[model samples]
Target: MPGVTDNRKSVLITGCSPGGIGNSLAREFHQSNLRVLATARDAANIADLAELGIETLSLVVDDLESVKACFADVETRLGDKGLDYLWPKYVNNVEDTKYYTVPAMEVEISEVRKTFETNLFAVITMCQTFLPLLIKAKGTIVQVGSVAGIIPYVFGSVYNASKAALHSFSDTLRVELAPFGVHVTTIVTGGVQSRIARTQRTLLPNSMYTPIESEYSRRVTHSQHNAMPHDAYARSVVAQVLYGPAPWRWLWPWAKGRKAWIWEGHRSWLIWFLLARGRPIAAAFKAATGPSVQSRLAMQQKRNLSIHEYLSARLLKTYGIGVPNGEVARSGEEAEAVAKSIGNDDMVIKAQVLAGGRGKGHFDNGLKGGVRVIYSPTEAKMFANQMIGHKLITKQTGAAGRDCNSVLICERKFARREFYLAILMDRALQTPIIVSSSQGGMDIEAVAKENPEAITTTPIDINTGVTDEIARTIAIDLGFSEQCIEEAKTTIQNLYKVFMERDATQIEINPLSETSDHQVLAMDAKLGFDENAEFRQKEVFSWRDHSQEDADELDGDIGCLVNGAGLAMATMDIIKLNGGSPANFLDVGGGATPAAIKSAFELITSDPKVSAIFVNIFGGIVRCDAIAQGLINVVQEMGLRTPIVARLQGTNMEQAHKLINESGLKIFSMEDLQNAAEKSVQFSKVVKMAREIDVGVEFTLDI
Candidate 1:
């Protein structure tokens, strides 16, 4: 009799915007004769929600104060019987009720903190707070999720992150609530037509673009806009919430739209044609996967954190640090004026585009243009006006216009301090640690020479906050007074907090200046944050100086793409390794296709160094038989003798082996990386032997 009153099905709805799931669910639940307690950040955001004659309340997930108040209001409204969502945890759910969030992409440190409070902690809080009510009700708990919870896409990172976290949370809830008669079900939808679709960045800004520009921007853009309507998505959400067949996940479209069904119907046809032929598709797979592996490995090898001087200049200016004073002169007059202000006849007026290259100036004597070491103020001023808003051509940017906006307007500070104090993450310490020295400026290595003992490393924990103990250790080394040491500790602590909370990868500060007046300034700063952590950090993304960042060859392109960072980098390196520089890096990931392979091949061969090509593919989920057919097609379309070497392993290898071995040219069967590497490297040897033996050689790879 006690449980009968609370036998109605219920859900913890999230994201109760005007046109959102929560509101829609509220209306649906009420219409279906189930209980509805609608909620939103602002009561007015859901005033119309009130018009629906259901529960509406203000619940700000981040602020504990707001959370406590919202629950109290809920209890007051219902009296004796009310309440399921007390929200003890600060996190709010973004799927049905909250926004999507990922740890790496969510970067506004505070926003990330807030998002977690809403999406994650709030779930815990609400569960604990409503434990008594939920137990009494004996109802099923429904959590809304999105496709992003599984797939990795660009942008929507934070939203996806939150949903994924919720998915995990729901799983835990299901296990824990099993004995208490509480059932948990998750809804994972794809292409839901919602306000999110309308508001989503259809054509993201250049900032969102990976280093490479997309060739299929139109196709990609169109696909993005073609998502399913919100109502259809809502219906499924309601069904899952009201029903209780929860095993792991419930994909909508029932038997009709299950991905495996669609994949078989669609891709199977293409696969069958290849399987029937047993010739073309097998060839192409071998061909495409060949270069992809090498490209991935090359990418990994070159990824480094070495600081460029251009970035070093600005970072040194922050933290009260100082670098050599420089002038932002465009024309000769401005250069002269800047020189006059300095009152020094000798001046170094360098090209201000965020690039490297000045010593290799256009003309000798360092005077014609670009960057010149002028002896007089008039000469400096003359160079300034000429460069203002004008393209500064260098070997790197070529003749095209550069994105140069500001010039460093500074007075020269000649070599007074030259010590390098870099606060680096010594993986050994596995934390943000400090590195300092007495010397400042110029050659950091030279300073390391004069006195290596001058440098000191200090580790700190930001949670306990800055303490007096660490302050004393640093003070003793830097020779600071107790007060100054305490101040220094506070600064260090703040900086460390910035590093961890913000998801920064590295914050390199070189030459922490101990000015002549005993004042400390950061002479230069070189900061790099995990790009994936951008969602949580607004400032980190804003500070991106593409001026110093090189474009990734495989970033955004149409190519015979394969996935795996290590493999992609290696493929690129191999091409270069074999004296054939890859045109670009393109990986197909889980969606590797012959067409994609063609695109990758085109992009890779775009470089003249790619005389011919060698492709090595390790098909794990992708069957080697499919890869072989792809290669066979490639050779038939593009013609064999395009100078290709392929080594394929994993499932269907036998079938693939049969296809390649039977193809006109002998598909070299080499075991292990040693022979495979040597085969590609010794393409000349292969080519010469085949030629000497009077075999047909396609193209001459001049390696």
Candidate 2:
């Protein structure tokens, strides 16, 4: 029962079906002289376990009913021995034969259900059922999460999101169950020698008919076939699992080895976030020389513009640099009062909290001081009165900071170039990557496009400081003349120094333009550090924006809960595509808490201009039963008359869908993203027809 004191004990793993990662792990553990019990959804699946001289049992991670029954069986078999360790190698990205593939439009609700049953729901049920045993064992519970969780592919968003959710859930579980002696470890593998590579290859049917797809199919298939061997990935997993102590998360196959397809996902996200934001990421997909998947996805990966504001204006202001006139005040009284005190005839008033809303002219949360242009104190008062405790919600603020207390008041400064600059951790280079550009302020991508050579990157050795030489070069290239180069170099160097010293994950400065006064000022800035590295950088980490966070991420909607970044990203994508831009990305796909859903709706509605909504729920671990109950209760209380198009799929969907249909709420069942997107736009138009595609759901106004 003692934890980590003895490694020579029994370990139980679920979903040890033949020729799978679980089966391989079971063999390795057995070979290591550990008592290994390998389980599967059915006993028939693990007949190979008997041949390997390991104990086998019937188990299902998805169904609580089946999981409970299996746990009872496991308890009877390994009582007191108590399963010294537990591993879930269940469902290695569904094995794709012909059945897994069909026309994209032909995807069935059942297929969606099949995916979650293995990837998300079952895992939850299994964990709960085994909690007592794992507690008794005082051992580790390892979840096999994926690199796809961090990245997204055109067709694979669902799988990627499920994995992402697992990663997030693992983090929460590790924190919550830490006091109970349960050690939770999540292994985020990049690529490995597994049948999954084969399965992924099969997900796309590469014939000449889809010429663009055929070529991409070949490239992806070859890359996957050559992925690192499964055994190698397994050894990494086993070593970490058995190494006595472990961290909450480990990216085993780092970025250097990842397929370009995956790497592009992560980079594009950061890129779009840096570049064009008020617009949908789909603008990036406008490239011609790409596959349908890439074309579809490129169209959706637009920047999260609010983030740019934080980069240039907010973070820079912290470094003792002058930003175009802006002031931070806590209350509307303070805001209006500050405007009067500043004596500026024209100033921008914004919610000062770490949220975005000022630009939208909504009840802004002051996240990054949601800034708004105002003529006088009266204007400030009008904005403040409306914003006070009114929930300045947005795509990222979630439901918590809707009513903003803090506001940023400042004189508007005229400037040019919506360019970007940032210091971020680069796992590949094992150092910080400095990204700065003469282009991309409001539109980083456009900036990049107009001036491809303008964006300059320098990798700094964390061991030493960023040299004046590198900083000077970057500044000079970014259009800083000789006079400003010294100051610019020093500034760039200091930013890197701060990045390393502060253990920052990201520190962005957007529109690093020359002040109208001819001095350099960061128009916006945002700083983020590694949570794990927080211990070393207390002061920096202490500046946590608990509310401004991508709630879609914390809530597991960051594609993991929703099953695809496309879905996750497209929620934002469709809104913008339909002429009704999204306030933020709220994914209610994974196991969404009722509170999370409520927050999502609240955040979406915070922008009055978001006249309509698209609630696309492709149920995974989140049951239709739970979603229906949650929606009915939450929406009624919110008092929203805005037309809401609800698309629910997965478990108990029929019943839940029926409930919504009869609820007398403004809800419509549209099957595709296209229909939903058009419906969302239409609502904004004449306000007619509620309907929706799944890669980027179909966009049709013909409804």
Candidate 3:
């Protein structure tokens, strides 16, 4: 085996595209004093590596001939030294929803074949070609597996299966090559921040997946939140491979806890196959049962769902469901007054917080509990005082507890029986499901864990609202008496109404109690509305709390203002690709107003780190001309001197360009997003250099 030496160490990584793992790893390895050869399908893609003393090569892993030629080239370059590390990181990810979400039978065979050709076949070929080199050096072979292979989430079957195959290959390779002293390590990657998530959308067969394309897109965008930054992920992997001498089989740098939970939850194929096969058949059955009835429930004219408890109560009342007659108190004094209004009856003073497990929580100032049973107004005031000003920590709240700014003082009532009633969107069924159980209260999750069969679920089609017959059946199944049947049925019907009207993703009444008076009352409820439907739910949208957001976002240097989440992410990535780090991600949303755009600008510029701004808008609902006007308004009013690059496309883009060009502002309005990104980076560099020069001149003057 070749001994470790700074000059002797060499690493070759394939698929070194800009903003990719290979590119990042190559750069980092070079910085660590290792000879780095960054290869891609096109050498031109990695041309920039020459500046950093990293060699670039055109190596197509998919082509067997290309793989052989690449090996020959590596051997010739390294001469008798032998290769230290050979990373064949060529990955092809197809974004077709069917490949991930649909049944394997539904996915096109061509797509599967194409994916395996790159991800599996190419990988195997590369490993065989490089085994000799790695054996010579006693180096590590890092196989980049994914969490998808471990969990195999719904709609990601093909990709998951491909990764699973790769993982198996790596394991087998490890055992076979152990005697050769070539170590094989599988990096089970969590979500890594990359342009692939954004750019891969275009590669999806949107026309073919007409039924679920929008949902697929939403899921793709939603998943990016947990993605580890590419550079950070690369650094960790490179460190483990280069510095760590121990034979570590798996390196998990992201979603450690999540991965563990997923592994535990992963079940057998019997349930999976049944569910996958039944989806379309079930949809067809549901459609046949109804005469294409439209929903009678009124849609929210304005606003979106924000705070769970308060909004839930309001929506429950609106739908005529019985709830405790109480209001949210922002202070201890207000809580006291509300307690008084309950006329000294037994009142439950509950700290209003976004997190759950509040009943088992404690306040920061040595307060024992978040919930307290109070007899007098004074008692309510005392508990409120302890909670409202202090942070309430629970199992869900972590160590840094959320601030309890408000409390709910509600009239407490005794119940003969508690029932759990919940309507939640089932992603697999693509419909809302009513989950009801005779046993309810705080231990509902326990019931689910220990006795899942006790809960009855009824999936409802969105087109057809919950029928009276369906409601009666569910109510009866929940052990409701004949007398309470009408009441329970009414509450269930009303709950569906509220869910439809508010565009709620989930409406959970944990303890829907049957009071002594035979009334079905919502004792505790949690309502969560779909954020995508926020535009229609104006009231709910207005309830958005910005305080819960990250402080760094409010203060970043290269502020990004984009329409869609994917576009915003892509813009930020491109900015970074061009050597400029984004300070904030400020998405003005699709139907953004000129006023909203102006507010976005002000918010982004508020961050002292922001010396440059990049705006990439694909105007679908929003016109580009309107966006231009908004930018012009901000620049003129604020006299903004920050270098701005705006890339406008779709929907009156020509008009937008014309308007921006004639605005007399120094903003660069470009037709191409790449050009805009490059311009922003150049301008940011100039700004930084100018600042440094000014400081230099000031120092000389002082001397």
Candidate 4:
């Protein structure tokens, strides 16, 4: 009312709450000597602006009557000279509509409609209502947009869609309004520090994204810390809006050099560059929302079940494959008795440890070798005494070697010719394949790398299996003697039977040998079974020595509990990638029952170095809700102090989220693999730091 008689440019701005972009814009425009009208839902919110000689109004942008009343008031104040600028700053209550940080599936349809009403439709109504005044003065319309419209960030589906629609509308409006002498400028904003960013948003109670609630919170206030100040943003925007361009100039059309789309705020340059180059931002989006390849590989690795050499030999014997007579011994007297029972002058004693390079390994009890050849029972006894209770360190075993709980004493056989043969599943072909090489009794991996040409692979049909013709051809190719060819063929067929019948993933015979007596024998064997087949292969699984495996369980900081081997391996790889050491890799199996989950937690927490536990489960065979209940039960029962990060996906995940949230425990549920891994690593570091401080304080007090 005071500036109604004066000849000054007037600008009306919406959503001018304190500490907001609209409020700062109002102040900036007022400083530039313009008659600024700052409006909010409540006029009292912008009283500070009114105190600074800026006109304040209460205008609900969404209400048509409110828009009409505000427009009529402005029309009376301006009289002949119309409004110069209209800034419609779209701002919604974050608490009511968390569509900005919620997944598309989890966002309510009603909230989506409300977002469009406020962000797009209401703004359009404002422009339509004020177009007459804007045309009278040849003024500009500034539509506040965001980079999220063009670049797809995580968990911003509805909000991004609304902004994108607004941008398109502005682009068309800019061209259509050119002839009317009313310019429309869409401000493509990046991160700007404002009150809206400070407002915390939460996911819906039944949200599928409940696991990633922390990520949503992080993204909601992401711009709060490192964003450009609202005042700074306001200064730049006002400067460009006021004197940047002429709305109507028929004499000089080229003089209209104002940007139709103005990019401002922090990271605006990066957004512009990305847009210009047409690069896909989906990868960046996926990195924050989806599971990684490393996690999948880790899960696959967990399903493999490897057995000891003696067990493998026993399996080979069961299949009627030729092997040297051998017996397991736990003590020196037992080894001597086994040697005598064999009734052979020459015998070999091998430490029963689950690792490669046993021949080249040394015992921790000052024994020179794990595998030794003896001519008599007395010599066998002496070597067995040294190896039975000692840890055998090999290339495969690190400094902390595997204990030799028993030894295998077998009658020695001289090999006339040695060859390598193996039956394994070919993942790509989805069938079994036989791999063979003339080179044997050495490192198979090195041989494959150095002399790849020497190796031969033959895919086996699942229906027909290994035919006599296939086995004979393989025997001849391996250079078996004419006398041993039939025996070799039989052995090959039997090995295939063992592979199929036992659900074996891999059966590797390092030396399928032709003995001095022209006997074809499997001299040394290693078998790996599919862990998923544990129900059927109970006997094979029974031979599993848990003590000899998962050596890192004692030393690592983060304990991993994953359902599948591939996922488990990926979890571990991601943990290491994020600078956290995995203390143990435990697959609770596909069942994921309460007992299994409880056992897994107990095992993981047993290691004092495990500061945090990461449970990454994909519930395909098992329900995620079941696993979640089990996890809650374990934590409450055990009273676990170590922090747990559980990422459950697949079957009944929504129910799982509900169970976890209602559990009232300190466990963190995460949806993104990368975020979960990073959180686990962070928790581990915090725990370690706390422990170190406690130790330091205790040491000082002791002194």
lDDT, each prediction? 0.48, 0.57, 0.67, 0.73
Can you write out model 3's per-residue Cα lDDT over 218-331, one digit (the tens) per residue?
444323443567776676556545532111111112412323222221111111222222221112112112111111001111222446486578768887899987878887
Give a tens-digit lDDT track for model 1, residues 502-530. Answer: 56555555545445554444544555455
Off by over 4 Å in 2: 1-318, 353-370, 393-403, 416-419, 445-453, 549-703
Report the CA-based lDDT of candidate 1 relative to the real structure: 0.48
Residue range 236-308, candidate 4, lDDT tens digits? 5564455331111111233222232122222222222221112111111111111111111111433366777
Clashes of each: 127, 73, 18, 17
Models 1 onward score TM values of: 0.44, 0.39, 0.43, 0.50
Candidate 2 structure lDDT: 0.57
Model 1, 484: alpha-carbon shift in Å?
6.0
Residue 565 error, candidate 4, Å? 9.3
Tens digits of per-residue lDDT for model 2 on 1-703? 2233334577888868777777778887776678777888787778887777787877767667777887887777765656667776547545433222333344566665666567777677777878898888766777754445433333454555556676667667765565465657665433455444344443335444365665345333322422444455555456435531111011112322223222222222322442222222223212210111111222333223123232335565566666766666666677778788878887776665554334543443342335667889888877776665666655444455454555667776666334467776533233466777776456544543345456555666666668878888888888876677787787787777667665566677766766545566666666555556656756554555444444332121111123345455535544443455444555554667688888777766655445466677756567776787788888799986666777666556778877877787776656565576667666654432221111222232222
- Pick by lDDT: which candidate is best? 4
* Candidate 1 wrongly placed segments (more than 4 Å): 1-407, 413-418, 426-429, 446-454, 462-472, 479-504, 533-596, 635-641, 664-672, 684-703
Candidate 4 Cα misplacement greater than 4 A, ranges: 1-305, 538-555, 559-572, 584-607, 613-683, 689-703
Residue 605 of candidate 1: its Cα lDDT?
A: 52
RMSD of each: 22.5, 20.5, 17.9, 23.0
State the number of backbone clashes in model 1: 127
Instruction: Return the candidate ranking by lDDT, descending.
Output: 4, 3, 2, 1
